[model samples]
Target: MKGRFSHGGGAGALARGRLARYGADMTQSLPAFAQNARFDVCALGNAIVDVLAPCEPAFLEAKGLVPGSMQLVDETQSATLYDAMAAGVEASGGSAGNTVAGVGSFGGRAAYIGKVAKDTLGEVFSHDIRAVGVHFDTPVLEDGAGNGFGTGRCLINVTPDGQRTMCTFLGAANQLTTADVDAGVIGDSAIVYLEGYLFDPAPARAAFEAAAAAAHAAGRKVAITLSDSFVVHRWRAELLAFIESSADIVLANEGELHALFETEDFDHAAAHLGRIVEVAAVTRGAAGSVLFRGGERVEVAAYPVEKVVDTTGAGDQYAAGVLLGLSRGLSLAQAGALGSLAASEVIAHWGPRPMVGLKSLAVQHGLSL
Candidate 1:
């Protein structure tokens, strides 16, 4: 509310590229503060280790892969791909998991609930997330990787254009159950963020419902992200009912929103979204984002970026910016502004996680970090 514009129906953007670069228009940077809640955002989703390496377009064609998307694969295919590619850099990643990591990068207190196995890659996943300041206490599946199957891994192939084709072996990550949803963590968090991809594993659906109920019972907020367009198509009715009943805030990219509401026209689908949920944020790549709340809707431009190396984690990072901003008591418009900033940073790099402390960057930009 300080410097953020609140005019309804596509008013001028409050934060532009120049202002974002200098943070001159921001009244203050987000501050690291003590809150009554234990965590800023409690993220509940799959836990995964991402293996990233460079490849050519022909590789994708030969392997029958879909560029710029994710899908499940069998253990044999996972092994073949891993063996054929160049050595990759392993990073901990998942849709909502990346968001909590980004929130932590912004110096926000965050917690994670997901499933992983007791194996090499699983340990790597745990250590990486914790190193970034996210609290994770999910119990590990013992002897889970006894054979070739182990922790879930998303094999990411980044072509020259910075697009990542992902093939996932869900493995132990899909084993998450409602019992994995920690009631205390959900109750202690200011908001519980759920990843729609969890629907891939039926038990994760129960986990999501449990987490949402816990957060609601504790009077906290519940947020959901339509993780992928395909995912929305697969569970449209179920997702809509869940959002209408339990979701306080909804996040989706333009394609996903269209798929969810069954219309290609963004505005037509967006109107449907605003009625079902209290608030919704729709991301439009370089076009920026639009936020809808009741009768009011505001547009926020995307932050300027010179390059887009890998879009693997852009949406998750955007959600990170928004959730952290909301938890820090920022206005809706200001929260979207922060989301744009985070998305811009992730697109400029190869990985989903930031290389620098985002909180410090916000301070440098003249925000109250």
Candidate 2:
């Protein structure tokens, strides 16, 4: 997992100096957006509930599961896995859903758009998101009798090292369509964030394009996250096209970055990212993150946490902080620091959502909101 800059000597020194200069340019401003926008961030992705359980490494081996991969499964497969799992906890979660929830936890105005069925889990998803102070009013898909699918759910297995492996049943979550893209919501938000995990379905991909178009028409920015490395490998060409044509910001991890550029060389992938997108943020787990903007790169250190309970929503919460900070006019370095702080908090808990108020936590860490 080592990259060029991961080592010491001349190359590392050069990167550090560049990062210092980039950090000093905090006075620079981002592109202007409508000052009257209602929500700071509007996120679009699958609507799903998360079922998390702790297990031994042997459990994953026995199940023939990769320790840190996400796989799409059918309803029957999902049920069988659930039945075999140990006692677990259920919570409302999805890539974009968790990001918006993190935004709300930071006292930012946030909204969510995703498809859910008229079922029990759908009700739970709606209630949990609203309870966190995010606005979500997407029309629910009607559940037909004997359809065998009502709502989407992810079965997450967290090993002792905090790595999470997920098996997701998309179900009704894949039903999001262009018609579900509310132009008003797009226009009213400072930034519209799209989730890569939802790109598998044609309808959902269409919805992403529609939302991006609406945001641009109203002069707002659009951000996108490469939710998983597997997703990047699946749709690299399409994602590049979408980012070039529509996205103002791109968020990803080191693995996803590698997948996107089809390279093992981190420097090559990051350089390619800088040339294609206006702003890019790549998280490197414990090694921290790197931000690329206007040919400058800033490196932000990972915030300290005593223990890692689960790594489920680490990237999602990181997106939450960076997106919220950008919407509030924070510099890229400051935004990245906020992102690191938020990520640290989430990985210290069992679920993806924050256990404490992120705003308060940021203040305690000397990061002004």
Candidate 3:
């Protein structure tokens, strides 16, 4: 896969100048010996265990959850929700975690950074992620660690329509601080991807900045996902600065893009975003995605699925496709197409990560890997 990913346009000079402004030590716009780099992407975000179960709209109403949104809950709420939901399907999940795993599924090297407690759920999260071929180097929070929050978990209620409503207990995920960021790991990667949901805790917020700084110092591209619409409302200023100052690429859905720019008009927001960032990929549910790089726009239609069982990790999988493709030297348009293919896989199942290997699916879609 050497030289598989050369930015389609004149991104080398552009990325080099932006990276230099941030003080990355590089001789050229592109990193020297890209093939020799140890990893394709280093991802940082909450490390969470996802407990998903089928439910009804009445259950969501009873639990006071907003359909299709992620809401933070306490341990008590997590326990209660877990008890009330149907039989669960436990899986390792987090926005960027899923993306990194998706990268691994595409046969790309990937690394992840985030905090989890030294407990049962934490162990499960670690094992599941490692089993997927992603490297996890962040240390676990000990039992006596401050406040001793257990490993974080998201209780996802899946309705019949394949919509998922989440109630998350961040737990030790909130304990992430700047110290968890391994500068060496980030500096060795082609890109660093961050999840917007990590904004819940103050220290975790610092962790994001630290990773961004490390990635910039290495002249690696930085990518971020808006995560959810409400998160956009909560961290509008900071997220905007993150995109403008650090991110070379941004991932979002139609709603998140509109919310970030504070408007109902998507075309206006998409145009506004492209001006500020070098690359932007916006997913539009069944309609597919639009990839923006400087002034050029490329549209990739959504990959069709016979049945949409769960939309749990669709967006994350979409980001995974694009990031995986980009990190592997696929042009942005080619990467977006792969992203669409990955998204179609996740939504065809009950879990966030794909059940069938993504590499095989790519071949099935007639994409030459």
TM-score of each: 0.90, 0.91, 0.91
Clashing pairs in 2: none
Q: State residue 218's C-alpha deviation in candidate 2, in Å.
A: 0.8
Model 1 per-residue lDDT tens digits across residues 1-369: 001222121223234321222132432432222135788899998898888888999999988888877778888899899998877678899888899999998877899998889998899999999999999999998867985448898899999888888888988888889888889988889778999989888888889988998888777788999998889888989998898888988999998999998889989999889877877899999899998877778788898889888888989999998887766556567678778888888888878788877877766665443
| Rank ordering of all candidates by lDDT, starting from the highest | 2, 3, 1
Go through the candidates in order and give each one's C-alpha lDDT: 0.81, 0.86, 0.82
- Clash totals in order: 8, 0, 3
lDDT, candidate 1, equals 0.81
Q: State the weakest 10-residue window (summed lDDT) of model 1.
A: 1-10
In angstroms, the error of model 2 at 35 is: 1.9
Please provide, for model 3 over 85-160, each residue's C-alpha lDDT reduced to its tens digit, 9 standing for 90 to 100. 8997999998889888998897778999989998898899999899999999798999712474999999999999
Q: Residue 313: error of model 3 in Å?
A: 0.6
Off by over 4 Å in 1: 1-35, 147-149
Error of 3 at 362 (Å): 0.9
Cα displacement (angstroms), candidate 3, residue 92, comes to 0.8
Give me the runs in candidate 2 sitting further than 4 Å from their true place: 1-31, 144-146
Clashing pairs in 1: 23-365, 28-367, 28-368, 29-367, 29-368, 29-369, 30-368, 30-369
Range of the 10 consecutive residues with the lowest summed lDDT in candidate 3: 14-23
In candidate 3, residue 331 scores what lDDT?
59
How far is 325's C-alpha from truth in model 2 (Å)? 0.7
